[model samples]
Target: MKLALILNVIDPKIGGVMIMGDRGTGKSTTIRAIADLLPKIEVVEDDVFNSHISDYELMGESIKEKIDKGQNINSILIKVPMIDLPLGATEDRVCGTIDIEKALTEGIKTFEPGLLAKANRGILYVDEVNLLDDHLVDILLDSAASGWNTVEREGISIRHPARFVLVGSGNPEEGELRPQLLDRFGMHAEIRTVKQPSLRVQIVEQRSKFDSNPYECLNEFEAEQEKLKRSIIEAQSILSNVSIDYDLRVKISEVCGELDVDGLRGDIVTNRAAKAFAAYNSKDQVEISDIKQVIALCLRHRLRKDPLETIDSGFKVKKVFENIFGSS
Candidate 1:
């Protein structure tokens, strides 16, 4: 269910998710699996940041001049990047800066791509996100929301595409993001340790088998993985055709209103998420069930009117949604 939302950001721009939980859960594992099961992206060859061809046309003078006159800018397919952001990374490491060699040798300023640049149009998975530097987290939220990364240093400024799914996971026991940063995420999900006896045993057995023979495990799930990837690709292809009905939109609006959501983000995110789910399911339009399916994800991180009290935000969201849209 959560993976569907991450894939949604790839095509529908539904925005990123914040995952909070204890350690040793499947949070990171599931994210990696989703990344591996996804399709490769076609990017302009030699584009250090894997920027799209359209974006390359409007690139800076230095990058534009690098290409030969009348030279066809060819495209190449590469695996979609899955970048990991360690909590200890600095701003210079995450946002990059002017290339020192270019400035010294040619006396020209060139922007060096950073982790965020490499994560462009892909996934930026941050482990222990709550423990990250506040400044770094601010930059991530800003870049993810604005879809552009701009760095300024030594009187040189560079801007480029920074659009991507900002998947952040952290152990809540260690710490929590400030309300402001929490609200910045489009969605939030809680990862819990598996407690089902049968499921726990199955998980251990699967891990044992994979450890004994990794290649065998990959082959075993290759077909299923390929099929899931195809569904994502096909959904992205026909995403434009999937629309939300007027009544459903109103229901979404009403639900948000009843919840006393912060600004219009809850409403907007819910709409986008619902549409993405519909498209993923090969539906031409969104249904009430689709809206209900994503309402919790969309509203879980937002603030409520009774901020002084501690309440389960997910339950509140479900309550509001069910009240308006009826039980599923």
Candidate 2:
């Protein structure tokens, strides 16, 4: 679907982007393509936490083993961490718990890492995120915000970095996300089915070709995908140098104030999104246009409720932006 370009702009390494759309809009496919295009990362063999060069989630025993043996820890090539959270997961499964198998076999209480641990320094995808259990949503929101997972239950206490770009997709026909949880997402986009007959036919043909010979189709696009991978790596290096100037800050704060967004998070995300836009355009300094492009993504879900009408927050934000920045 060539969605890699849009995804590269909102990739986890650049912070995360949350997508809301209909079922057949290629959201999942876009995620898979992004995973395929990203560079492989080195991880510990057989480690559930996907331990990397500086993984702090390693158990004390594993650390001791590495130290005592005086053997260089080996690196295994694995796909960049992309963990999907199924809709029917329990709290223990999502946040980790005491390993029952280890306790039963060795009569010891060893902590077992869960999905959050596995998602370190990678992407976490949740389909139908709007319908996820409230408590589980709370856990995800907390980790997404704090960049750490802390567990205290059954006399087990541990805290490890669980930082990851949270990617979520859902059908708007179902229900909207809770305002509190919605604020945690850094960027938001709404996807819809391609309505044009020509585009619909193109989508079907592409899927048919892919299904018949997946490897062949992938090989055909491999070169283009590799080019994108190099671009993303370069973008990451350049993003740190992008500047958010004083005028840009004033403009950002003014937009939030005009919109009456609840808290400081709106401004924070807006700033980050503007910086990301600057990086995407290969510019060192953010421009007014950058702010215009990202304000909707950063603040769409944070607006006050209006049950009388359905407003696309992106459109509303764009209107406000044009009013302030002048149509360009």
lDDT of 2 by residue, 1-328 (tens): 2332343344443346667888878888787567776677777777666665545543334654675677676668888788999999999889988776776689776778889988876778888899999789889878877777887765656676776777888888988788878777767778878889998998899899999999999899889878877766766668878888887698778777888889888898788767766776678898988787768877787778788867777788788777777788
Worst 10 residues of 2 by lDDT: 1-10
* Model 1 vs truth, CA RMSD: 2.4
Candidate 1: tens digits of C-alpha lDDT, residues 178-249: 878888888888878888999999999999999999999999999988887788887787778889878888
The reply for model 1, stretches above 4 Å from the true place, is: 4-6, 9-12, 54-69, 100-106, 305-311
Give per-model TM-scores.
0.91, 0.88
What is the Å distance of residue 142 in model 2 from its true position?
0.9
TM-score, cand. 1: 0.91
* Clashing residue pairs in candidate 1 (N, C-alpha, C atoms within 3 angstroms): none
lDDT of each: 0.80, 0.75
Off by over 4 Å in 2: 1-15, 55-71, 100-109
